[model samples]
Target chain A: MTYSTMKPKEVRQLIREKKITTFTSGLCNGYAQANLAILPKELAFDFLLFTQRNPKPCPVLDVTEIGCPEPKLAAPGADIRYDIPKYRIYRYGEMTDEVTDLSTYWRDDLVAFLLGCSFSFEGPMLDAGLEVRHITENHNVPMYITNIPCTPAGVFSGPMVVSMRPMKPKDAIRATQVTSRMPSVHGAPIHIGNPTDIGIKDISKPDFGDPSTIYPGEIPVFWACGVTPQAVAMSVKPEFMITHAPGHMFITDLLNADLSVL
Target chain B: MTYSTMKPKEVRQLIREKKITTFTSGLCNGYAQANLAILPKELAFDFLLFTQRNPKPCPVLDVTEIGCPEPKLAAPGADIRYDIPKYRIYRYGEMTDEVTDLSTYWRDDLVAFLLGCSFSFEGPMLDAGLEVRHITENHNVPMYITNIPCTPAGVFSGPMVVSMRPMKPKDAIRATQVTSRMPSVHGAPIHIGNPTDIGIKDISKPDFGDPSTIYPGEIPVFWACGVTPQAVAMSVKPEFMITHAPGHMFITDLLNADLSVL
Candidate 1:
């Protein structure tokens, strides 16, 4: 089924049944898609503070109480463990496995955090006539590790990772205006032009995702990437952490515009 | 007295004296500065929804109960009348007089709203090493009447008025990030670059304030200006309306930095 015609719940049900295991980008087009980070219950408050401190990178879309599988605010009926098409299991900061479902790995001592993903704002950016470089080139948006540090809470602390999109200098300006209205989805670009100014040595070699084309008259606009928390999780080396694999996000019931400030 | 050395109460006392009746910008430095709008009780709820719908332009900092002269949340000890440095009284959408004290105009049927002002964010931006064009140029930030229509509530309606700042591309990007963290103070930019994109015809001739200089290699960034409610009040044409003068504003007791989200 085409994403443009599908509702978020219908898409989630297919993933829950193990009938669909693929990237969630472009799925349920107008709905919000979130990044998942499930940790042991003991770290809930500290992790909450971590997201609070670094709101741009780790925007708290919703947080479920300990041992809960449902994301009440973001997706009321959806089961967190089965709603996502893909899952990554990390042990001691190392990726141990990627799976289609996590029913077998479910535990009662876990806390779930649904974080704002760039997918939420990209749709608006496109509607506003702003070119998302990755979409044009059919590649992942390039991401770089920044020298900027995330405000630490407990063991969750690390440098921020930002996703870069190349746009005409004019579109870069428009993109900032469009994205600034949605604070939940890593609203607005963190940096524009001159990669070296933010400590990125090479624009071509991204730490994650495929590099898209940056043409003449276009500048690279960087946004606080959702990858920051995943990087933080790895840096902290939590005994065990579970997340959605890159590009395989958890689809939420929230409409992207509902997150708008005005 | 130097703003940094003056306490909030001292600043209020100075404003009440009618001696410091100029622009309140940069004065009472760390204390909260608000945009004032007073209307007859009949227009209060619609005005509230108008503010809720157009939050960036009309951030509701504090609302006084009908007939009450106190703003409990913003300034407990301050009186709504006679405390602001200056105010404009309007009759049937036309300003008739400007006064430093409202004691003669006080009425029990009126309600006052102290909306958050860009002045609150100016301090943080200055501290973050970003130049506020208006402050640097010693002029009011240029404001334009946008084609963007505010979500109308009841009988209150008007176009959103946005204040412009031209800055380096990187600074525009950083400004977006900085302002995004403060939802109460015109959260973020509504538009950036290409004034025509938002229906503004000319960059040099703004509908309000001094047209600022836009240096080469810089983008013109726009924030939903606090001047919106005044525009709305003019459009609605209530029997009575009062507002802070264009540059003059009300100083509240709240600290500016306390308003930052992260």
Candidate 2:
């Protein structure tokens, strides 16, 4: 089947049947792909406040009302547990196992959060003629641990992690302006020009993903990575935390254009 | 009283008594002091949609029901007619008079809208050690009519106007991250580095306010100005409109900190 006409629910059906378990990026082109974080109902409010406070790092696309698995705003009629290509189960902040299906792990007390991913902004950036390094390289964009702190809420507190891409200063400026229109999708670049300024001691080695080539006059621009919230969630050592493993994301029915402010 | 000591309501009361009608810059330091626009009920729905559609430029803080002057969210129990240090009345979209009071002009059908202003973000910026150039220079930030077209709603349509401040590239980056947190206010710098990029022909001569000094290392940063709604309202040639004159803002009983996301 052509990727152009594939529907999100169709894609989800394949994932549920174990026919498609690979990373779900660049599929369903204009539709938004969200980061998933399922937590127990008791921790939902704190997690909600955490996202509300640290919006840049955790721009929430939708939060299923407690005990519900459906993300009404992002993806209706889709099961959160089995729709995503992959999921990671953690116990006491430690990764327990990676699974393609979560039907066995699903709990009624779990509240699902569909977070805005960088892929939403990447669409506009790619449309603007700016090359997304991750897309070009066919790999995940390099993410670095930063000195910046996420605003603490309840049990969530940790340093902000950022994804980096090298761009000419002019392109960096243009990217900032374009991304500012979509605050829900990590909004704008958190730090532009120097990675070391944000406390990334070594640009050559990222905490996540492969480092990209920074040509002469090309500056490294970093945006508040969505990994921040997931990291914060881990730091709290939530007895049971469920998140999509890196690269695999929950595709939503909503288009990326719907998130634009202007 | 010290700025840190005074409560938002107390400061608003002081402004109402004419005991404090200065810039109101640092007062009520944390709560959100909104940009005011009082328009006839006929244009209220369109104007509401205008803000809704163009949230980046004109963030609707609170809207009063027809004939009611109270902004329950921004400044409850406060008189919109007298709380503002100064007001500008426009007839057929042209400025006709400036006054300290709007008592005589207050109509039963006038709808009061409290839109978010840069002043709300200024406090957070200063708290983050980002210097707001206009505040430091003791002058209004330079504003320019942009080539960027605002989304049209009914009879409201025009170019977005932006306020510019020159800062180092790092500060501009931080400004984007900081302001992006406060979506209620005009969030983040719209453009950075070049004035001509946004169609501002001369950097020295702004369409409004005193142009400040741009030093060697400074990069010009622009933000969607609150002036946008007023400019859009004017271009449509509204029969009657009232706004806060430049620097003379409506002092709301809300703190700048109250508006911050995290």
Candidate number of the best TM-score: 2
- Tell me how each candidate scores on DockQ against the true complex: 0.04, 0.03
Query: Chain A TM-score, candidate 2?
Result: 0.96
Worst 10 residues of 1 chain B by lDDT: B44-53
Tens-place lDDT per residue, model 2, B1-262, is: 4854688677767767888767667665566667788889778756765765576799666677567776655677888888888889999978999988788899998988787777777778888998888898888778899898886765778999999888898999888888877776787678898788889999999998889889999999998988899778878788899998766676666666655444
- Model 1 off-target regions past 4 Å? B1-28, B31-262
DockQ, 0 to 1 scale, candidate 2: 0.03
TM-score of each: 0.56, 0.57
Which TM-score value belongs to model 1? 0.56
The numbered model that scores best in lDDT is: 1
Model 2 lDDT per residue over A1-262, tens place: 4654699888888887888878787688899998889888667656765775576898777777556777765777988878888899999989999988788899888878788888888899989999787778877789999999776655678899999988888999889888877777887889987777888999989998888878899889899988888888888888888999887899899899988755
Docking band of candidate 2: incorrect
For residues A65-99, write the lDDT of model 1, one tens digit per residue.
Answer: 56779886678898998888888999988899988
